[model samples]
Target: MNVGIGLPIGDPAALLSWARRAEAGPFSTLGLLDRLVYDNPEPLVALAVLAGATSRIRVQTEVLLAPLRDTALLAKQAATLDRMTGGRLVLGLGVGGRDDDHQVAGVPLTTRGRRLDGQMEVMRRLWSGQAHGDGAGPIGPLPARPGGPEILFGGFRPAAIERVARWGDGFLAAAPPTWAGGLFDTARAFWREYGRDGEPRLVAQVNVALGPDHVVDEARAAMHAYYAFTGRADHMVAGLLTTPGGVREAVTAFAGLGADEVMLYCYGTDPDQVDRLADAL
Candidate 1:
């Protein structure tokens, strides 16, 4: 599996520096996690800036909450970023689990699944230069790739896997490496069942914290804040690895599972987290 790092979303001032640090390290991709009701940079905009900062590293939305945004606008944003990044953008779509995100978007949570399926069709068509509603012309600054950025979706539920086989390039899942093998197996099985012509790309991501005693503590604190919405922050805190040994262990375990890429998300936003993880992996 290829190793990648998430660009820290906090401290917007330091975001680019973190991007540069990750690009300079052993990371193959720089990823972002999207949150609507949180203090975080808008992910697509973040990539627009980071695109100019690094040339070799691929960029992805670890998983973006697609149903929350207007599909046409989202397609335009992603297409522009793909052009700017030289086709390095991998779009990961999902109906986020947070009810508040849907509430704020004025989107009914129950309809998200169906809406996302339609949105995927719309976005892919728009990216392919298809004419829009009425007399609107094809989207400009066409995607760097002819068919548009490679697309993936989050989760491995029956419906989600069906969506992937029908429209997406692969599956993007989040779980500790040790717990991911079964998930990968299920997705690949469904990929074949649907008669997709080739193997589906599988991406896995895990949360970690690797640094000094203080930074480790800070990392846990950060997770507590982020997962507070789930009412299981304490549960998540207990599993976060805080050492280089733990980080490397998970990466190796996931590599054995055949993940196309496994991204490590630092619980702490310390820019040094990038170098530390690269060294560990």
Candidate 2:
């Protein structure tokens, strides 16, 4: 499987440096996570900036919260970004589980799934040059790719996995390989059930921390802080791959399960970790 690197949670000043390093390394994509109520930079804008700074590597939202945004505006923004980036954008979206995020965005938490379902159709139509209403013109500029940038859906629920066949180009498994294999299978099954012509792209993400004890500890702390809202930070922390061998093993396991790409989610802030990870892998 191709390996991608996530933008680490660290000094904002170092983010560009980190992205540049990741591009120069063996990584295939630069992935970012999204949270409306979090202190981290917004994934789309940050990724656009990063994409401008890098030449070859793909830029993606590992999973952006789709139900929190205005659908039409999001379609326009994503399309513009895709056009500007020369089709390097991979938009991975999910109906986020965090209530606070929905609350902050003024979106109803209970309606997120329905909202995402409707929004997907609307966005697709807009991207395809359909007007919003009788007098309104179509949104522009069109995406670099004809049907919009390649979209991947991320979520644990069956309905969410089914969306890959109905609306998405692939599945983004945010869980570890062991837990995510079943989800990936469900997505593929749905794809076949819908009579899709080819296989749905399967991508897996794993939390990773590498380097000296202090840097690794920093990564552990960052993960705990981010996932603290789930009340399962310890469980998430327990799954982190800290050693070089562990990273290699996780990549191999995900690849064995037919993941097209494995996103190594680095939580440490150090930009040099990119080089270290490249050497390790």
Candidate 3:
């Protein structure tokens, strides 16, 4: 299985440093998490900059909250990025779980799932050179491909997996490998149910930190703070892979589950961790 690295939470200099180092490393993709209510960098814009700075590794949003953005604008931006980056963007989309995010974006929380479904439909049409209105011309800056960039759906719900068959090219699993086999199975079943051409790509994510004891501790603290909104930070932190052996084992386990890629979410902002993870792999 291929291994990808996630952008750490940090300032501009630190982020660019990590991205540059990550590009030179043996990583397959560079991923970023999304949040509008928080102080995190906007995933699309940040990724565009990182992609501009590097020519090799693909850039992805681990899971962007699609319901929070205007559908047409997002389609334009995604298509532009896809063209600019030579079709290296993997749009992992989700109906967000945060009430504050929806509230702040003026989108009702209860309608997010349905909104995502409609948004995907509209975005696909827009990306395919379809006009938005009766007299309106098609959105400019078409994507690098016939459709838009590759799309992956994220969530643990049945509807989310169904989206893989309906609109997405793959499933971005947030669960650990041990608990993810059934989810992947459901995704495949839906893919066949929909008469999709081939297997739906399966990608798994894990929180990882490697270095001295202090770095691991800092990584755990960062995860706890980031995911505290879920009320399961301790449980999540307890599952973190802190050693090279642990990372290797997780990769093997995910590969055994037929994952196409494994995204290692590094919670710390040290650029050196790029080499550390590459060496470990």
Candidate No. with top lDDT: 2
User: Tens-digit lDDT track for model 1 on 152-224?
Assistant: 8888577876777888888887887666888788788888888989788988888887788887888888889
| TM-score on alpha carbons, each prediction | 0.95, 0.98, 0.98
For 1-281, candidate 2 gives per-residue lDDT tens digits of 78999887567668899889888888899999999888888999999999999999999997999999999899999999999999999999999989899988999999999999999998999989988777888989899999899999999989999999999999999898789899989999999999999999999999988899998999999999999988999999999999899999999999899999999999989877898889889
Instruction: List candidate 1 segments past 4 Å from native.
Output: none
Global Cα lDDT for candidate 3: 0.90
Range of the 10 consecutive residues with the lowest summed lDDT in candidate 1: 1-10
Error of 2 at 7 (Å): 1.1
Tell me the tens digit of each residue's lDDT in model 3 across 108-183.
Answer: 9999999999999999999999898788889969999778999999999898899999999999998888888999
Clashes of each: 0, 0, 0
Task: Report RMSD for candidate 3.
Answer: 1.0
Comparing 1 and 2 on lDDT, the stronger one: 2
Ranking by lDDT: 2, 3, 1
